[model samples]
Target: MDIHGRQLQSAKQHQVFVNFRGDELRFGFVSHLVEALQRHQINVFIDKLERIGEDLTNLFVRIEESTIALVIFSRRYTESRWCLDELVKINQLTDQGLLKVIPIFFKVEPVTVKQLRGAFGDQFRDREWEYRCDKPRTERWRDALASVSCKIGLTFEKKSNESEFVKIIVKEVKKMVQPQENYVVVPFPGIRRRRDTSSHGRQCQEEQVVLSRESAVLVQENSKIANQIAVVSMRYMDIESENSVIRAQLGELSERLQSLNSIIEVVEGVVGKVPEIPEFLMNPWQIMSTSSQPITASADMFYYP
Candidate 1:
């Protein structure tokens, strides 16, 4: 499907996965950007893998198929091995022309990124010490950052606030998409004559027929992918629902167990405080209490007593 003039190349209908290091503000900012994209009818796939697990490799695989990656470059971001690994994979994918990476530098200087200094420096310190030299390591890091800067637009600012960052990012994406409105359709070469030659007209008709068939096929493929995504989403929802039910049941069971324990404790305390009594006769206290109650016994009760 095409939006405006730009082809919506995603196979899944409403999916975009966002991968970010564990920065609350960064995640919120990306979520806002996603909302903006959704407003434009773009499907986003978001990976909340942090909640699920910390296996960076698994996370990388999840990110590999995404159309675009938005990286939030904070001071702490470089410190995370998973984040760095993700960046490396992104760099690889971008080099292979498979995906686009957008870098949003939050409160981190471009110089710091370029130099791999400070937090970045610390992250790579082990490797640097392994090589027994800092200069080569720093140079390679600078080159990598420079390449990333050239390939992916980097926004460096002091503000780490999510809302402000989202606004800036949305504006930038808007500008990028603005020029694509005109590229949607290229007009067929203008025909000079009212009627084409018979042979040329037949060829043009055939070409038009072919184009129509291709368009239909593309639409069908898109529909199929959309259905698949829907199914996957539904499955995820079911799993989540099941998990919630299980959790609720577990909570109830825990409460019941606690209540049982409390009851047992109370029973044990009462039993411990009770005085011993002969099996065949009532205790003095019990007999006195019964006598004070103005007992009305039948002939059978008196005989039994």
Candidate 2:
């Protein structure tokens, strides 16, 4: 299901996916940028909800269908095999004209990112030796890096203060995610007339018209089915979203109930020892002590009389 209340039968929209290793700063920045994109009504997909180690193939599958791949360049990013493979795949896709690769340098120098040099250079050299390849892959990586640098200006920021960095990236992403007119589908010429035309040469014209009407009806039925599928998908999405909200609220209510239970327990413990009595009434012992002797003397005097 998609935001448009459709079944997402095809991947036609511009999808941006963020690719980054477990660099906390990079994740934070990218996450903030994703929120910004959502605010701007841009559909953004993240690689994973949790960190998966060195599974380049899986990560590639996750982002393969995306239209835009946003790569976060950091110093430690070069050391990860998965990150390297993702970069290679991005380059391959670019060569195949399948995707647009955008590089955002996070606390890494532009020259380092472009040249694939310094720490990146050392890592690539080590890998190349291990593979014992006839052709070095560094050139491809360098070309990809350079291409991205030229196409989109490198955004550099300190790793400590990533909020500001996220804001900057969000601004850039918003510019890239501007809404454009949808592609118009042109129908074949004389399609309606062809259907309307008689088939007197081959068969009865009435039969041809009947067949065409049946075909049109079938097409309409198929269209209705597709629309129904889309509507059901959208309803499921709404239900899932509502479920998430309900779960969050349930968690909050559970916490509040626990707090209230604790307070009730404390109040019960405090009041349990007190005797039950009316505050305005006197004790029975006080009334007996005050009136008993006078009542016995009055009864004896009346008997003597």
Candidate with best TM-score: 2
User: What does candidate 2's lDDT look like per residue over 73-167, in tens digits?
Assistant: 77767666566667777766654445666788777776665555578657755765665663455444434445554445556756456667666
- State residue 129's C-alpha deviation in candidate 1, in Å: 5.8
- Model 1 Cα lDDT, one tens digit per residue, 62-105: 66556666666766665454565566666665554455567776
lDDT of 2 at 99: 64
Query: Which candidate ranks first by lDDT, i.e. highest?
Result: 2
